[model samples]
Target chain A: MPADVTALELAGLRKSYGGQAAVREVDLRLPRGALLTLLGPSGCGKSTLLRMIAGFVEPSGGDIRINGRSVLALRPERRPTAMVFQSYALFPHMTVFDNVAFGLRLRATPRVEIADKVRRALALVRMDAFEARFPSELSGGQQQRVALARCLVVEPEILLLDEPFGALDRHLREEMQVEMRKLQRQLGVTMVVVTHDQEEALVLSDYIAVMRAGAIEQFAEPIELFDRPTNRFVASFMGVSNLVDGIVERDGEVSFRFPGGARLPVVSDLPAGPATLALRPEAVRLCAPDDAACRLTGTVAFTSLVGSRMSCEIKVGETVVTALVPRHGSGPAIGERVGMALAAEQLQLFAR
Target chain B: MRGGAMPLLMLPMAVLMALFFGAFAVFGFVSFLQPASGMPGYQGPLGLSNYLRFLTDPAALAILGETIVFAIVVTLASILLGYPLAYIMARSPYRVVRSLLLGALVLTFLSGSINRAYGWLILLGRRGVVNDALLALGLVDRPVALVYNWTGVFIALLHFTLPYFALTVFGSIRSVPVQVEEAARDLGAGPLSTFFRITVPITVPAIISGAALVFSLAISAFAFPLLLGGGRVRLISNYIYDQLFVAFNLPFAAASSTIFLVVAIATLCAFFWLEGAVTRRRAAKRGAA
Candidate 1:
């Protein structure tokens, strides 16, 4: 079932170290059993925000609530949350069984009950027969699984993950991503993941919170955030986007121009004014020089083969515009003169 | 040639080793040839009498007991004091604090044995600053006699060994990855639990090595015990010194010194074995996982 519970809430949270603010005025609403990802570049406060939510960092101002109960004053151990770190911080001395049993042991749970719960948690992560193994004996992916199992054994109200797969190889990272999402769904526990990788966020998050210097840039559903970014940073950060500077003439007749002299027709209802425009590289198509409607002309400067697609950089105006063409029969050679037409709807204009 | 140079380097030490070995061998052979008979002079043929006399002597037994207790107490105290100082040194934010600690450590090694013992002697004496404060504060009615006893010797030993313990343990603590501690905290372990469960266990090898070194030094300590003990407490070193310098019984003293060497090696080997066992246990646990 979809989470009808409000799992966690942050109200105007702020944190500063010494005198410098690391996280400022951050507020969020996380649904119970939902996975929320905070995405941004390094030092953008995403990790800081996640740390605050996990209670590792005490917010200098504002409050946090878990399961509708205020947890602002609680210590990390007292808070009803657990964090999985990027380094897979499994205790090196303890066996997998003991590491998973640590939380239950801390709570003074019965030995038999602790054993049962650890066994079940390990099974959930599909790591059932590895109980006696120390963390050092496992591979990177196995260690990550052990870490996840350790966190889940606690059955906390929320699980906070700080780039849990950041240390894994690409293949293992992707596999863990799928496995983590499945586990989160199966157990119906809320999860908050922090990562700078936009693709990982898009793959795992129900809601993506894009953070910039000490503030949230935008927070919305993954599809909405990617398709309609609120600003240039989000647009460029989310994926490959071509930004063209231009001025709208009047009454939705928009013409987008690059740094050089080349211009392309764009669709916008913005009043006649200077503006910025954006288009995905895949949205533009290569055409013969004769087909000039809504077209920009330039010399094809460089070409790179990416899988089955070819990306060509065209010197349009004073800016280099890239277009990704499907590598079908034939395509333009480097230095070939080309005209690229942008689909009218694909070009988006905004006020500068 | 590399092989030729190897033998050249070994030759000097080898000759020295042979001479040292030859002296001990000759002493042993001579000790058996003539055994001590009356009030304490060799007069007869080879027998087990010399060995039996030394092992059964009450004074010899007391020295052995005192040496073991001293080694254990000094080793324990060094580890207790050094672990916290090492932790602080490894994590202190200010470079000046680290430099000050390092400066203090260097000062520990600055003075000769007599000078360092004298410093300890003054502080621990009944009329010294420590007892003066105790009486002035009414913590005691009279100045307590702390010097010229085992307590005085222990204080001196602790002073001599603490800096070495700190320096060695500091290197080990520094190598403990900060990420490990952060991971523990993130996993909901409190600060104290994380420290004991993670940081302390990982550095056990260093602690064992440091303890073994301190124990060896404490057992063999001569100047500190001789100066501070002031004829009250007799350690193995003092006993050996009296046997050699006062009694001039080279064979008996050699036998006692050889026993001390064997005990030291045994203590070191025991600690190394314990550390190896713990490591193997951890590795086996990982394999099971």
Candidate 2:
């Protein structure tokens, strides 16, 4: 319970099925009252890692410590952790009130205290009015709220959620993501969420661990992970559409040499060698062909409207670059020559 | 084409049902006639004398009451013995364990009923393996009366009905999502608590349905009691068989068959009603909460 001690820690945690490893040597230290998201694609071992922390799935190696004490030997029911499953596994035979009070009843809490705590937990999720309803009677979002209340009522030391909004529609999923973040801040409870959605992680997490295969690819804050991804995989996963393979040349000044003898000024600390430049579509501005700020010249091959932005695919010496510009006028026509001005600060360079 | 072909496809089943019900109707009509000492063994002048005789005969009424009580006991015993087996078969993590249990149950189902009855008699006879083991172990001073009475008949009947009960409940238990039980454990309930509170309650309807099936199967039992009862454990089916074959009184047999049919139908109706109430009360209990 000390402030300096981490709320949850995993040291060299691993899981393997037969010869194939599902999670390999994961180490994390989450401070108290902070939310961390394990973001990854399907089958990336995020769910398995979360299950290890919840004491549902036994780790193949290493230890999981909660409150600076090892909980590896404890059973799931004995551990001080609760999880909200993706399917919202609520007891169909029990009312919402009883579902929330189940853990308290197991602990032999007083009847009056159980009722009081269940009521407050339901209120926390804005589901106090549905105490008398069964889980089958509620909508998906409402059942999700009850599922959250059922876990929160137990006052676990660490809360875990496994793709909690995977069943909801888009608009509702976004709303619950924001609401979950707000509730976590208000309660100041340490939490871990597993999700395959990058946007959901960005909206809900204090720190995001983008995972690939069975390891953490990059772990950082939202802005840092999006703007300064450490590798090509992280860059692509963060929606960087343009990855131009080039070489860094330090002749006179730092410059990136493209494959077809085109050079563009860049700022990097890497020595002159092979590298890849990660450019976001929205970071490129379409301008007049003779503009002084133009960094590349190409002919537009295709144009399409994306909401309020126009996406243009420009062919630059056998390499196609996509630029997203505001849809004010008719935008660029196909086969029209144009200049692309890349934002210098937003450009990311990665060693190949 | 979809709707038109359905009825034509059902025509054979309709004819089969008509023949079955037609035979039952003839038997029911015979219950109202008077028995005569001749071929066909029936006369005109319809009356309820056969029914009145059965309603008044204390010995016959006693047999009916005893049969009902025995059926109830066997049904309750099957539930107790079969539920755990069904649970293991449905939820055991090991495929070998589940397959072994299911294979044994299915093997019992596939075997001939008379063959199984004779097998039980050989195993449970006075000088049979079970009694010999008990005597050799010095657990009993004498061989227990396991056959030729109520005990032998009860054991055989339970064995016969267990597969019906267990298989009926197995599919239901499998349908209860594994995550529901895990959610209970994640919420601080132990394994046993999760089973009783979450898994069992959710499968109540199936349990009742299985119990109903076993009850009806046990109540109308004719072969086990005939083979193992040693003329002592005569159930309703045995009584009807005696009246028809031994006594050659077709009208009386028809009357008793009608009564048995009515009782069986009533019991099945009650079970169905209880199943509905269990499901409805789950949703209705919300108001009280």
Among all candidates shown, the one with the greatest TM-score: 2
Give the best candidate by DockQ: 2
Candidate 1 CA-lDDT value: 0.83
lDDT of 1 by residue, B1-289 (tens): 6757788888999999999999878766655534353334555556665567678998898889879987899999999998988888887879988888878887886767788888887898888999999998999998887888888888888989998888888998898777677667656678899888888898998998898889888989999878888798888988978977788675577667777777888988998998898888877766654
lDDT of 1 by residue, A102-138 (tens): 8888788998899899999999998887888878889
lDDT of 2 by residue, A106-126 (tens): 999999999999999999999
Runs of candidate 2 with Cα error greater than 4 angstroms are A1-5, A250-252, A287-292, A333-337, B1-18, B37-40, B132-142
- True interface contacts retained by model 2: 0.88
Candidate 2 per-residue lDDT, tens place, B133-156, comes to 999999999999999999999999
**For every model shown, what is its TM-score relative to the native structure?**
0.90, 0.93
Best by lDDT: 2
